[model samples]
Target chain A: DQQVKQNSPSLSVQEGRISILNCDYTNSMFDYFLWYKKYPAEGPTFLISISSIKDKNEDGRFTVFLNKSAKHLSLHIVPSQPGDSAVYFCAADTTMGNQFYFGTGTSLTVIP
Target chain B: EPEVTQTPSHQVTQMGQEVILRCVPISNHLYFYWYRQILGQKVEFLVSFYNNEISEKSEIFDDQFSVERPDGSNFTLKIRSTKLEDSAMYFCASSERPRYASTFRTDTQYFGPGTRLTVL
Candidate 1:
């Protein structure tokens, strides 16, 4: 059973355009959500995250929005850059602490 | 920036052979976790260790799999008998504490460069 799911396997967008990646979770115990970016052959790096209490959080060009009732979350990158092309994984932490559940990940390609 | 580190970026082993992957999580982090990603598959959690004992583990982490914090700085994952399906990239991560974005704390996990294991 997949507790976290990223339905879109791949997405392509023109440079300077908006890039939105979506994720959904079936478990209600998750209280914190995070987005990680990964390059080929490299470990994932923390991007941004939002707490269960917050609806939206932003940093630089990256913003994460969470909808607890919908059990959905999304990462939005405004004016996407070519360097932004990478696989993005959405992960959530259960209240139990430290244990994280990750989605299958969505590959985003920002075309220049 | 203290980042997690893993040794032997890639390991090739025969089926039924034992394979051990090693990691060095960031100093001062108390929570250690292991995750794996099969080619074209999602990253799956294997186990989480805190205070030298497993706090949580997935079903995939069975009797054949074990974790150890052999020393102060080393975390290891050992597969007793490797199976062909065990081939995947193994990642080690560490976190200072639980998720608390509400507090705007930097408790997020840091991942090491994954160790790719190929079981033949």
Candidate 2:
């Protein structure tokens, strides 16, 4: 099931620069979207999320923007640090289904 | 800062062997889930459990796979007969949401450090 997809397999950015990670979903019924960061040998860590009613949601240095009409979403991280290097995954779900669909993660590399 | 925990960070078993991976969800959480990610592949959902019963499962969760909450704290996934293709990382997650509540759009899931299972 390719409901959610992350076209970019890798991203590189200089430290202190803005990093943008993109994700796309094919399902229109999805009402909830989330971004997760994962480190090697560890579970994914929840970053930020956006609801269908809101076009954007921000948490500290992280922000998630959603375009329901385009079935696309993006996560932006500013002042990227070397510690920010990890895999980011985009996920979507239809709320009531209680099941989540995930994208093949994008690995981010922050060069110091 | 309570977090979910899993046992046996890594396990290597022979084919046809029965392997049981264990997880302990955070207290007060009612929903439990299992997901696996093969190397270089997307994370796939396996099953979800609530109220001591399975709420939903995926096609990959065939007859060979089973889940149980034998006690109050522990949730386990038992693979009846391990196959060579079963090598992957298994993650356990839990969410705090009342089953009957409908106003909320979704429940945030907290994941535990995955257990890497290697089947020979």
Candidate 3:
């Protein structure tokens, strides 16, 4: 079963606009969420992460908001840039261990 | 900055042949892991190792697969016999601690570029 899911396979946003990506999870045991960005033929690069204790975490133009009651989370990029274009993957970690469950990923395109 | 590195960026092997994928995690990182992504699929966890022993492994990690931390610097994944279905991009990651909240150098994992293995 896919405990973590990213229903949207692709998303597009114009440069200088906001880009939002959504992720949902079925496992309540997961407490830590992370986002990773990847390019073709390269391993995933760490983006941003949020802990269960907080509802939101922001770094620079990237922000992650978590809604525990809804079992959902999202990543938002303001004033999106072409460099931000890449496949974004959402991952969840359960208390059992540090191993992560990753979503299929959503490809984001920042159109100029 | 230190980063995880994998050897033989690409490998093509015949079915039923043995193939060994190698990785060298960042120095001083205590925890190690292996994850695989089939083309057009999500990344799946394979195994995690610490203190020279396998701490945890997924159901996908069967008898045919084994992991070793030989000596000090090298971590290897060996598939006793290759299968056409074994083809995928394999990534090696390492973290300094066991908690996800820790920094990649301390808690989060730093991933290698990845090794693409194709079994014919």
Candidate 4:
């Protein structure tokens, strides 16, 4: 079963516009969520994360918003740049331990 | 900054043969993990290790699979009699502490340039 899901396979947005990627989870036990970005042939790099205690967290141009009741979370990048084009993955960690479950990933393309 | 590294960026082996994938997690990190992803699929957790012992493992990690931190720096995953279905990209990750965000160096894992194992 897919506990974490990203229904959108691809997204395109104009440069300098806000880009939003969404994720949903079935496991309510998950207490921490994270986002990672990957380029072709390269390992995924750390992006940002949010704890269950908080609804939103921002780092530089990236922001993550969480809605516990909806079991939904999203990552928003303000004034998206061409370099932001990559596959983004959403991951969750249950309260039991540090083990994580990852979504299928969304491919973001910034049209410059 | 220290990052996880995996050897043999790509590996090809005949079905039924044995293969070993190696990883060197960040220095000073105490928690280690292994994950795998088939093309077009989400990354799946395989196992977690701490203090030279396995802390958790998934059903996908079967008897044919074994993990070892033989030395201080190297962590290894061994697959005995590999099957065609075993072909996938394997990644190794590490963390400084047990918490999700706090105590974790990255909160996000530092994935290796994945070891792509192709079983023919």
Note the DockQ of each predicted structure.
Answer: 0.71, 0.62, 0.71, 0.71
lDDT of 3 by residue, B31-72 (tens): 999999999999999999999999999999999999999979
lDDT rank order:
3, 1, 2, 4
Question: Model 4 over residues B74-107: C-alpha lDDT tens digits?
Answer: 9899999999999999988887767743644444
Q: Which stretches of candidate 2 lie over 4 Å from their true place?
A: B98-106
**Weakest lDDT window of 10 consecutive positions for candidate 1 chain B:** B97-106
Would you give the TM-score of chain B in model 3?
0.95
Which candidate do you rate higher for DockQ, 2 or 4?
4
Per-residue CA lDDT of model 2 for B2-120, tens digit only, reads: 99999889999999999999999989889999999999999999999999899999999999999999999999999999998899999999888732254443367889999999999
Clashing pairs in 2: none
Share of real contacts kept by model 4?
A: 0.70
Q: List pairs with backbone clashes in candidate 4.
A: none
Worst 10-residue lDDT window for candidate 4 chain A reads: A91-100
Cα lDDT tens digits, model 1, A53-84, are 89999999999999999999999999899999
How good is the docking of model 4, as DockQ? Answer: 0.71
For residues B1-120, write the lDDT of model 1, one tens digit per residue. Answer: 899999899999999999999999999888899999999998899999988899889999999999999999999999999999999999999988755432535578899989999999
Off by over 4 Å in 4: B100-108
User: What tens digits encode model 4's per-residue C-alpha lDDT throughout A15-103?
Assistant: 99999999999999998899999888777788998889999999999999999999999999998999999999999987667678999
